[model samples]
Target: MNCQTLLIDDAPAVRLQGAAGDTVTVLLRGAQVISWVDASGVERLYCSPASPLKGPQAVRGGVPVIFPQFAARGSLMRHGWARMRGWTLQPWDTSAPEPSVSLQLHNAVGDDPQWPHACVCTLTVSLLPNGLRMALTVENTGPASFSFHAALHTYLAVGDVAQTTLAGVLPEGAVLSLREPIDQIFEAVTGPLQLHSPLGLLRLEHAGFGDVVVWNPGPDAGLADLPPLGHTAFACVEAAAVMQPVALAPGAHWQGSQTLLSGL
Candidate 1:
């Protein structure tokens, strides 16, 4: 296992390499996992090249940590402030069998005034053989209770979005194929999901999340952060708890995770 600090577009980032040639790169800006390469050197996550790497803006792709809120459903900023705030890197065990790193956010002070709450959030990314696992834990340290929603907004790389098929615990032989724009939230997702694309087979498993969000903007969405035809190369399959907000009392904590297995 090896770890190195590198800069992407002048922003500080950490790259963790496993002995098997798999690697994961995490950015300090949002504690985002921007890249994941399998042992065969194939990138498994899609990150937009046109997205801004610096500042108060979130990166366009990769696994974005959505916290406190989801979308425009709250009074706070869309997706909350965790994805825009810088996080401090936590020390990890270098002697571990697999490469792993953790980043933490102490949201006690200097957070959004509208959502006043003292909380701590940590994101840990661990590299596996031809796979990656991300875990998010949130702890409330204030005297009052608070409710919030969160998700691991994961963007999966594909050879072509039109040629991809996603399968869950659906009707027999029924799978989702993205040929047009789609933004659907699935509730009570208790089973694993399989994504079959031209690149290969990938499996997604989630824990402590009740919902799964499948999204693709198609070709005409015209997102400023994405290049033209960029929509053809990726799909968003997120593990989320959005419909039901989680309430944590003072001194309470909660955790959720999403794992991705490539070439499976």
Candidate 2:
């Protein structure tokens, strides 16, 4: 059965129930978190919401939604034009044994004049027995070559953000920004990520990524968008992105993935 039926006429931000009794919802304005359920007992992944190229604001948490190219310096926006454009549910696969689904967002019409790359992108969310899996695949449909970074931007829910730590990161020479001014970016985190606050301990591993960004927006930091968490409910251990730009060939295909494990 097509899972689209479960989401057929529902508003992008409204919640709906699946045929198998599962649940799904959309955040209209944010078009993020396309699908969600409570099978394993709690919400696992927050899909969509592109992560910014660098950042001015970069949304606090809950998948900022990514697109065309990540971290591309331009007048248009931080991350290309994908997250800013409205995506349609093209080919959804909710029948998989793992209860998976895929949504297609293409920029053939060159939605944003600034980002003139014709491309077809797919966002997939697959549910596993233990947790959830999210993957992004981009295929260049244009003649010109281009490249960008893609990140899941997961904000794992924790009992407390100040109490957690991140493992599996470069220990030295890692670049990071401070909570208050954030006026300038610094390089540090020379090794793995480890969080030892009041919350808990967390670990993140990156294969294709170069640096791990461990961000915990404290009360002192001014944030525009904050996820649904207690005062400091979530912590971000994002897979490091390309500090340098990636070059893509015409018709080139690129993919990025990140996984979050709890109870560590």
Q: lDDT per residue, candidate 2, 1-264, as tens digits?
A: 324433323334434344445554444333355444544344533321342322233334455455544454446566655555555664544456665556667776356676677777776555444344566677888899876655555555555554444433433433232222212111333344444444333334334445454555566554434433323665555553446545578878776655433335
> What TM-score would each prediction reach against the true structure?
0.97, 0.69
Candidate 2 — worst ten consecutive residues by lDDT sum? 177-186
1-264 per-residue lDDT for model 1 (tens digits): 688889988989999999888899999988999999998899999999999777557998999999989988889889988899899998877876678999999987446788989999999899988799999999998999999999999999988999998999456657988777899998888869999999999999999999999999998898989999999999999999999899999999999999999877
Report how far off residue 174 is in candidate 1 (Å): 2.1
Positional deviation of residue 186's Cα in model 2 after best superposition, in angstroms: 11
lDDT of each: 0.90, 0.50
Count clashing pairs, candidate 2. Answer: 34
The Cα error of candidate 1 at residue 33, in Å, is: 0.7
State, as a TM-score between 0 and 1, how close model 1 is to the true structure.
0.97
Evaluate model 1: give its lDDT. 0.90
